[model samples]
Structures are given as structure tokens and as C-alpha cells.
Target: MASVSSSRSSPIGKLPVDVFDSILSILNEEDRDTLKNCSSVTKQWHDRCVRIIFSSLDINNKNTNAFPAFQTWLSINVDAAAVVKTLRIWKLPVEIDVDQLASVLAPLAGLQNLTLQFIREPQSQIKSSSPLSIQGPRSRSLNTLELLLPSEANRSMLAALTVICLFDTINTVGMQGFSSLKPDLRSTEGLTKVHQLRLQYLPQACASEEMNMFSGIMTSAHLRSLYLECHSPSSWDGLRILSQTFVNLKFVDLDLVQLKNCVKDVDWTTLWKALSSCAQLQRLRINPPSLVDALVTAPSKLFQTSLTSGGCWEVLRELVIGPGYSPRAESLPNRIQRMLWDLPGIVRHDLRGPFPNLDTVTVEVPLSAPMQKRDENGRSNGLAAPTVVSSEQVKSAIVRALPSLQEEGLLRITVIGRT
Candidate 1:
């Protein structure tokens, strides 16, 4: 038995440190929990495996039972905190003192990314001098920060959190579900240096003060990439600010959605004007909201006229439209055919200027159609999901439009389905 066991022994644990290191390095984030168990097998494995395991921490207040233990671990294994490069806090726990949490994270000087997602209405107004305002040592290394706020979240809290230890080194900022933040945040030292800004879920009918505050934030930052997604067509108050500011802007993505009743010609014209004013923009993506109508009388002429009148997209290299849904009076196949035949003509007329840097124009079509499937007997097939159009026809439509495009390799089509 002893001889057999000796012959069957594994050499994985005894491998050279570099070999073991390479193996751990290749492991994906999902394998970290498994690697954590391996960390206990031997001292050599523990050092490397533990470091990798603690590199990213996801702390959610919903997991109430496990949080205290996590906090205690951070307190005891102070060195482990140093390895954490990414920290995500889903919701702050009311029971735990923010200062204590800050203390636990104080040693995380190497932290590079932080995400704070808080939507819960505060139990009480958080004072400017609240313990949560206490700065931690590692806040200086945090460069990329994502702030997710619920509509009801206090703007003061958003400003206070932004001003925390995180204010010093943050350069890239992503905000979701916040129509506007405190105007005072524009004066914060960190926001002025931001280069990439992404804002999503902007509320409809923004107040003048709120628009000013949001505009101030955008204008103050020397943004290179600005991505905005709005809940309604009328919510894009920041477009005016971008046209005048963000002189260094390179990439812009506007995902604008409108209610069935809100689609108007002025909206499209406003959008085109905004695009024209961005003289330095390189890549542009416009995902128009789904307009539920029997026929969205192909605004091809309007698009051509507006784009031609507005100045040329001087450095624009790539343009993408849709993953859009437009319900027409005709059948799915007919509508697809019309869009394919019409889009190229629109592009030919609209884009007559010197597109020296223009390269690709992408039409993104959604696989799911707005119509119901029909059976052979012309009855609604309730068992099957709705089919708008087939993927092949969509691709063919893009292929047909290619010849009309200014550049040969310029036309591309992308089809995205419900995730």
C-alpha cells in the first residue's frame, strides 16, 4: 500500500514557484473561490493564492451574516487589504460604522478601482461631517470609480461620497440613475481631471437648476469619452454643454429612448445638431429609442437634410445606429427591405462632405421584432415568441447598403438579441 501511494503521488504542489504563479495568474475571476480553498493546502500556495483571492472584493449589505466576518478578516489580516485592487460596495450597511469600514480599508493603498452602488434612502440626513466623510489612506490610488444612485438618493450624500478619500485620484467616472448631482462637485479636485464620463438613466423633464449642475460637471471635466443614456427624448439637456465643451472629446455614445407618444421631428433635428457641433469627435453611436408606430415614415430625407446642413463630422471615423425597434404598418420582412433600400440612399445624400477620416457605418438591428408570429392558417401562434425578422435578411439589407456608403469596407451590420 505504501509503495502504491508513493508511485501515485502528485507533483502539482511541489512545482516551481513560477510555474504555480503562472497557473494562478491564468485563472479567471470565477475560479477565485476555488483558489481560496487551495490557499490553505500549503504555506507556499497560501501567499500567492490569498493575494489573488483578495485582489477583488465584492461586499454587499444584503449578505448581512457574512459581512461582519469579512470586516473582522480585514481587521486581522491587514496585509490582505493591501492586495485589493478593486472594491465594490453594493449598499452601505446602517449597522456598521462608516469610519470602521474606512479603517479596514485604510491600508489598501494599492486599490485602483472602486464602485459604490447605493440607492436606499438614508435613514437620516448625512451631515457634511459625518463619519462616512472620513478619508482613508488608500483613496489616493483609486483612479476609476463608478457611482450608482437611486432616483431618491440624497444629492448631498452623492457629493459627500465623491469628496471622500476617493476625490484625489479618480479620473474615469461612471454615474447611473442620477439626473444631477450637487453643483459643488464640479469644484472638487478629482472631477476636474476626469477624462471618461458615462451617465445613464437620466430623468425626463430636468429642472433648470439640475441641468445647470449636470452641465457644470461635464464642462469642468476635460472629458475624452462621453456616453449618455436617457429615459426620455426630452431629457438630453447636457447635449448643449457637450457641443460647447469637451473640446478634447473623442468618443460619444447617445442611447436616447422616447415613449410611444414622444417621437417628433424636432428631437431628431436636435440630436443631429448636437452631433454636428462635436468637431473633435471620432466615434459616434446613436441608438434611437423604439418608436411604436405602424410606419415610421422613413425619415431618410429629414436625416439627409439635417446632416448636410449641420457641419461635417470632421474626424468622425465610425457611426452606429440602432439595435432599434421601429414597428411599421407593413410586415416584418417588408419593413426590413425598405430600411435596407432606404438607409443607403439617405447616407449617400446626407454624407456628401469630405469624410476624410470616415471609415465604417454600422446598422444594428434587434433580432426580436415587435410583431407576433403567424401559423400556416393565418392564426396567431401564441406558443412561439414574436419574430420581427430573420437575421439573414437583416445582414443582406446591410450588404445592399454597402455600395452606397462612401468607403468600401465602411458598412457593417450588427444584430443583437435580448440578453
Candidate 2:
């Protein structure tokens, strides 16, 4: 047994070089690149490593000289071309001639992921022989597509829109533009596989109308996961529309604080109704004002009723109450306690709260001083002890309010605050 173990541990008696090279070829490009750099130290390692490292290529610069060289390299290494799984081409000064772009991308039929960025301009006229004009059906293995637009105002909106609308099999899509436009699903009807969508920097216009359109798109597509961040107030109407449409959603992360101006005139009641309707919600993260206020102002019957009485909080697994807006020194803890207790389904009684299934509670607290350490003798070290409420007291209040939940299996609680 000892002789067998010793032989297995010896790298000198490992598999032959060809077998090792074949194994390394299966790794992703980042790992393959590392192996390639290490292989260059010796002639024996160089031949085995270079094939895997150069198997995938990224052409990022748009300079004329690099483009031709890249084309030449591709022509000389036809076998290696089939191994490329990811392609990223960017910084093109002018809108690429549709035919030229297609010719470059055609050889990469095996590409599973593609990214095009920094398109300075897009052509108004589609070349008759260009790939852009190729309307016949073509099968592609592409599943993920990311397009980044230049920040220039004169950028070609038509070309950018065309490129985005063309990907038929994309399952994940990300775009950064002036406004998050819901893709014309009609244009990419074959993209039924798409489940994840991200929209950033959406322009604020007539918030209500745009939001309605956006909601219509989401409901029609049955998107499962969504991330939306907008900086303009006009984006609020869109958010409100989403709150109304995505009631059956499972996961959502909304950054509405970026659109402070749009929310200035927000209808709190409508937003609350939208939040209450999300019956299948598993994970949710939004700024405090949007989520906390809705819970506090929800109908009294919703909170007062038992868990089996169609209360919305019964399904919630996690609750996070963030910091208050500009808390006053005199009534900070009072306000925090009131907000915590007032939360529907959360009880002040010893452990009989409505959140029976709640396993975690996160609350943001503010501190006036640094925390002090306790000595082994059970005495305070007195290192300018922070004027903060005791965790035990807070825990006691929670335990008393929802004893039933704690008894059932509640185990973890976290309080987040600034010192």
C-alpha cells in the first residue's frame, strides 16, 4: 500500500505530454493563458501550451494594421478558428461595413458568446451585399450578447437598434444606452430562451407612459430576473408600472434612489399595492423609502390578520429595513423601534409574530460612539463605550414579539448600522 501511494504521488511517472496537453485544452481561456505563459520557459512546454492559449482570440483595437494581421492569422490557422468560443471586437471608429463585419464573424460559427462595444457611428444605408442585408435563416450557437454604445450624442441610433434587434438565440442581454428600451420582441421572436435582462441609464420622459410600455414588455416576455437602474425622475413612472406588472416575479433588485427627481411625486399607495401583490417573491433589494414606507402604510387588516388570513408577509423569508432618511437625534431609536414593531406580521408579543418562516432579519442602526470591549471578569473595559442600544435588548424585543417564529426555527438575525 505504501509503494502504491508513493508511485501515485510522483509527477515524474505521470501521463505522457500529449495526454497532459489534451487535458489542458479543455480548460477556459484564462486558465489556458496562464499555462501558455508558464510553458514558454521550456521548449518542451511551449508546443503543448501555445495551441490552447491561442485557440480563443479577442480583437479589441480598431487600428488598420492590426485588423489585416488578425485576418492573416485566422487564414493561416483554420483548425484553431473552430476552437474559439468567445469573441470581443470593439473601438471601431466608423460603423463597420455590414458585409465586412459579417465576413469577420462568419468564420466564428462556434462562438457561444459575443460582445461589440464603442461603436462610434452606424451606417444609414445597408450595403446590398453586406451581411446586414442577409435576411435568410442562419443557425448560430450564440447565447450571450453584450453591446455597449459610445457616449456621443451623434452616435447612430438606427445601427445600434438594428444590432440589438438581430440576435435571435440570445439568453442573456445587457445594454447601456440613453434609455432602456424594451426590445421589440417581434424583431427577435426566436429569442424565447431569453430569461435575464439588464437595463441601465434609462432616460426619463413621460414616466407613466414609458413605464406602462416597459411593463407590457416584461409581462409579455415572462422574464424571471430583472435589474433596472435609472438616474432620472422620469424613470419612476416606469418603476411604478413594473411594480404593477411583475406581481408573480421571483427575484428583483431595484435602485430607485438614482431617480430621486422622478419619485418626488410618487403615489405611495399605488406602489404599496404593487409590492403587496408580489406573492412569489423570494429575494428583494430596494432603497428603504420605496419598500419600508409601503409596509408601514399597507392596509391595517393585512398586518392585523393572522398568517393564514391571506397576509402578504406570510410568504416573506427575509426582511431588510435600511437606515431612515435624515434621522433626528432625539427620536432615532424610538422611530426605529416603532417602525420595526409596526411592520405587518411582526408582533410585539413574545415570539408569536406573523413571520413564522422568517429565518433572517436585517436592520440598519446608527451609532454615536465606538463599541467597547468586555473583560473576562464580566466588567466593562470602559474604552469610551458607544452610546448604542444593547443587542440583547433588541433580541429580547424580537423574541417576545415573535416567539412562535423563534420556536419553530428562527436562528439568525443581523443589525446593520453606521458608527
Candidate 3:
């Protein structure tokens, strides 16, 4: 028994510090909790494991009072706070006293990532002040900043941080109350370094003013990706601003359900005129289904003519068009097929089913046609009417369309049918 016990403990004790660190890195919160409870087994393990496990701190209103206590603890154990890499504070309903927040933020100057999701009421009006007044210690090591302000007005704290150049990469900056922000994002210095921007629930009250400010940021040429989610119809102005200003955009994800309103006012000629300038665009996704519905509902002749007159679908490599709530009359698959047929550069077509690339054709055939599947002598079963296209006809169409596809060295074909 003594010999077996000695062998069991030897391997764990012999593990290198780097191997232990790697194992600890992959642990989730529960696993880390277990490790922390067991840290007293050895002095070397206790020192290294405790530091790695407690290197991230999350604070919110529920434990707001604890922050001061944490500061007191950190004063005695400065190395503990200095090692923290990620700091997240969110949804503090009450206005945080700036002095209190500054004290907590001061010790977190070594943080590599910081996220703040602050809630402020829309009706509440606060006097404007220069963000410079709230500047804290600069974090030269910080690289990512995520701000989620639910109120329309800017958070003076975040604006101040941006002006002070606290972050280097500025990975994601999301604004929830965009309509409420004063249209002077330029006031926050170093915004041009932000690579990803997301605007959620645009304020309906002040559309144009907010959009103009948004346009100024996108025109900076350094922005690489944008995500816009409009909750109200009036927020469509931001889409118009993007369509007009962000000509050099390479990737865009637009969730503007209210885009139909913008489409109503859009001059196809002028809209495509601006879109054509996105010469390097590689990926584009439009959501909420309304945009496609609007396109299909437009008089067919007008839609076709607009496509022929230089639309923006010429260079797309990947396109996703559904999983949205739209009317059945807007046949997305048929519309996509038409668009691909019209665009000469679209060599690959991926749609609803087995049709992988347009080079090959795939078809699904039912074991029995609706008419043939009727209960006696092929008469109506008095149930919902079945589709008219037969499986054999669909297979025939594939054979028909194959010659043209094969001419491009695409003879591969797949067929699937349901009984």
C-alpha cells in the first residue's frame, strides 16, 4: 500500500510548471473552484494556481459595496490586483459616484480587456461636460474595450477613456442608445483604431443627427466591419448614411428590418452608384427578410432592369438569405437562383438543400406525386392541395440544365426525393 501511494503521488508532483499552467488555463469556473479548494496540498501549487485562477474580476451593482473591500484587500496584496487581465462591470442601475468608480478603475490599469454595460434612463438629462475631465490612468497594455450604454446620451466615463488612448486594438465598441449620443464621435480621440462597431436599437427620436455622426466614423477608412440592428422604423436613416458614406467597406452585416422604408425612398440608380464604389467588398449579409421581400415586391421589370444596370451582387463568394419572418410569396430560393443566373462571376451557388455548387445539380423527388398518392383511383383526398411539380419533372429539369453547367466543367449532380 505504501509503494502504490508513493507512485500515485509522484506523477502529479513531477509535472512541470508550464504543464500545470496549461492544464489550469482550460478549466472552467467549477473546475477552478475545485482546484482552489484543493490548493493547500503544496506551497508551489498554491502560489501559481491561485494567481492564475483569480486573475479576472467581475463586479456589478449586487456587489458594488464589495469593490471598496476589494480595494482594501488589494492595497495589502498589490500583486494580486496587478495580475488581473479581464475586468467586466455591468448593469449598475444607479448612477455610480465618479470618485468611487475612479478608485476601483485606478487599480485595474493593468487590465487587458474591459467591458462596461451601463444603464441610464432616456428621460434623465445630464449637463454636458468634456470627457477629458474624467480621464483615469492610461492603460497602455489594454487592447479591447466593449461598451454597452443603454441610454441615448454618451457615457462620459467611456468617452473619457477613448480620448486618453487607453486601448490599443479597440476590438468591439457597441452602442445601444445611438440616437441619444451627441453627433460628435470625433470628440473621442483615437476612434479610428476601432476595427469593429455594433449599433443596437437605434434611437428613433434623433435619426439624422446621430447618423451623420456615425457616417463620420465610418468614413475614417480604418473601420473594417460594421453591424447595425435597427429596432424601430425611423432608424433606417443610419442605413442610408452607411450606404452613402462607407464606400470602402469590405464586410457589412445589416439587420435593418425597417430598410423597406429606405428602399421606398431609394433611387436604384443612385444607390447602386454608391455601392459600386465598394470595389474590395467580399462578404455582405442582409437580415430581417424585409429587404428581400421589398426587392421581390418591386415591379418585376424594374427589379430586373436594376440588376442589369450594375447591382452590387457581382463579386459575392458567400451569401446567406433566410431564417427570417417574411411572407411566403417572397420566394427566396427562386430569387437567389435568378440573381445567380444574372451575375456572371457567381460560379458557386449554395441554397436551401443538396445543391452544393451550381457546377453540379441536385434534385429531390417524391416517391409518389400528390395526385398519384391519392387514396383510391387518384382522386382528391380532401386534404391540403399538394405541390404541382413532380419529382420526375424536377429530375428532368436537372438533366436539361446540366449541359450548360457541364460546359464550365461541372458535371457532378446529386438528387434527393421524399416519399
Residue-wise C-alpha lDDT for candidate 3, range 1-419, written one tens digit per residue: 00000111212333234444455567888655545455345665555554664466665545345566556655654655676788777654324455555567677656677776667644533332433344544435445666665554455333433332434446566655542445245453433456667776565675576566666543446566677775555545456666666656666675645544454554445434444455555565444325554544552232233344565544444433222233323232343332232222232332212122222222223333333124544344556455444445544544454345545554333333432
lDDT of 1 by residue, 238-298 (tens): 5754566566678888775443445553355566676677778899877655553422454
Q: In model 3, what are the clashing residue pairs, if there are any?
A: 152-180, 364-416, 365-417
**Distance from true position, residue 414, model 3, in Å?**
16
Ranking by TM-score: 1, 3, 2
Task: Estimate TM-scores for all models.
Answer: 0.72, 0.56, 0.59
Give lDDT for model 1.
0.57
Error of 3 at 163 (Å): 8.8
Q: Local distance difference test, per candidate?
A: 0.57, 0.49, 0.48
Q: Per-residue lDDT tens digits of candidate 2, residues 30-102?
A: 6556564653357445434434544445676555344655555556546545656777776754354544565
Which clashing pairs does model 1 show? 294-328, 294-329, 369-388
